[model samples]
Target chain A: MTVEKLYDAAGFKTISKGDGKKEVKAIFCCDMLSIAMSKAPASGCWITVVSNMNTLAVATLTDVSCVVIAGGVAVGEDMKAKAETEGIALFTCEEPAFETALIVHDLMNA
Target chain B: MSEVKLSYTISGDDFTRAGEASGDVKSKLKVLGVAPDIVRKVSIALYEGEINMVIHAHGGTIDVTISEKEITMVLADHGPGIENVELAMQAGYSTASENVRALGFGAGMGLPNMKKYSDDMNIETRIGEGTTVTMKVFLQ
Candidate 1:
């Protein structure tokens, strides 16, 4: 699915519309930057509560298609700006990570 | 022989900028048309090393050399050296404080992941001096 489609379907608040047409091949849920750095799939959607600069760095390194910030974590302005500059789609939802993953999983499989 | 050499000075005080160097290297590797899996491997290993430098070593320097056969990264830091290399290599062993864990790091997977991703890994350290990590990922 495309990032735009997931954003609309998941009801996530869009912070940055980076490459809305980018394809999302899978969904990964993890908060540990170390684990995500090595395990996150390329062109996949990353579901995490990590809303920091390093989160974007790992996302970029893993080539994740988009980052869905779960648990309504506050994202810093600098991080948002970096996401836009890096062309990484950023989204947020009040739901916790598992719930967020369920939403993404349903949409992705449906 | 054409080879690309890159070096960066990592600042220990800045946790937010920890992965900048690794991200830049990942981009460069991609631009060079390196395979995606290979790029990811190199990026992950280097990024783990970068984070370690920030969290434990009070920052450090990373030198990377990209050649046709392999990509080599050497990370050297002046902070307190690891007391036990064998234990540090074990997953789930960490000296990072609670604050570091709150940042979603300090899970003790840093060194293991670096070794897992790199084809060859080596660590050298002194009790009161410093530590240096050298890793290589072969381009097949």
Candidate 2:
């Protein structure tokens, strides 16, 4: 599945940039649990972590495509720079974590 | 490939560098060319152990051994020994102070998550003494 497919299912109104047709097969959406669960994505997981700099660390380790911050999750500038430098996608949404998880589920399953 | 082993000291006082050990291990696993899933499993388990050491143990040391067939990790902390390992293993059960929680930790998910990710685990601690955790993740 492409990032656009996930965005549409997640009801994400805005996209960061340069996400044309990148593909992902799995998704893990949550906060702090990114420490353990995020890294355990089946394969091709585009994790959605709503934490701060820590999420950046998980993205680097798990080789995620994009990290969608659910419900307008926010992070500091350092985290943003780390994500950019690591070449990981960072996005946000207005829906809550659970809702975002559902959307991610449908997208990955579809 | 040559039975790589790395060790690091985790400082509880410095929340800024909590994940440093995990980061190093992650990169090491990457260099070893481990499968992404295996690397992730090792890194997450070790990362949780690192956080637990930083939070509960005041500070601790982690030793990681990686080979062609397996990854082994040992986290030793002299902070405060857990009184009840069973209760502590429960999800949502955390002894983290409010201060630690404020730093986005102490969620009570550390040990459980570690056990969930690792193929084998052993935790030994004495109340008021210290704690040592050993976990192993096998490569397929």
Candidate 3:
């Protein structure tokens, strides 16, 4: 699913533009980078992380479809530049990540 | 190319800042074009180690080496050593305080999760001196 769809599913508001056409393979919900890495599905999945570049770094390494910063969001200039360079879409939302995940589950199921 | 080595200090005091090292490693591996699955394995294993450092060790140091064939990570801390290594390795075995559990960890899954995500892992400890964990994840 596109980042837009993900937000819509979670009933969250977008903070940045995202590639909404990106298809998602799986979803991960956690603030910890390691747990997310361990639990998140393989590439083609969408990851909702609560951390900053650190989370993006993990996403880049894992070849995720994109990263959606759910609740507490922080993305610095360096991280944005890196995400752009890596073709990793980084988006932020107003709602918490867990709630957003519920939306994602609904959307994916539908 | 030869194996590339990286090291970082893990702070046990800050829960919010715990995953910084793992994040850095994941990004570095991504930029280097390591396989995605291999990267995940490293990320998960190292992330678990980072949490362990904060929750149990108070802080520590991590050493990571990436080669064309394998990735190795060694995490060392001067915190109280594991009293029961075998039990700690269980999926539900945890000695983390209640506060840690409220923070979303201390569920006793750290070591088990680490082993599940890593190809190989070894742990060494002194009840008072500290604990050392060695983990490996392969890239095929």
TM-score of each: 0.97, 0.77, 0.73
Using lDDT as the measure, the top candidate is: 1
Q: What share of the true interface contacts does candidate 2 keep?
A: 0.24
For residues B1-140, what per-residue lDDT tens digits would candidate 1 score against the true structure?
37999999999958889899999998899899999889889999999999999999889999999999999999999989999999999998999899888889988999999999999999999987999999999986
Model 3 score (lDDT): 0.73
Candidate 1 residues lying further than 4 Å off, grouped into runs, are none
| Predicted structure 3: clash tally | 5
Candidate 2 chain A — worst ten consecutive residues by lDDT sum? A34-43
Q: Which scores higher on DockQ, 1 or 3?
A: 1
Candidate 2, superposed: residue stretches over 4 Å from native = A1-22, A34-49, A98-110, B102-104
Chain B, candidate 3: TM-score:
0.96
Q: What TM-score should be assigned to candidate 3? A: 0.73
Q: How should the candidates be ordered by lDDT, best one leading?
A: 1, 3, 2
Question: What's the residue-level lDDT of B43 in candidate 1?
Answer: 91
Per-residue CA lDDT of model 1 for A1-66, tens digit only, reads: 788886676558888889988888999999999999888999999999988988999999998999
Instruction: Note the residue pairs that clash in candidate 1.
Output: none
The model with the greater TM-score, 1 or 3, is: 1
True lDDT of residue A31, candidate 1: 95
Report the Cα lDDT for residue A6, model 1.
64
| Model 1 fnat value | 0.80
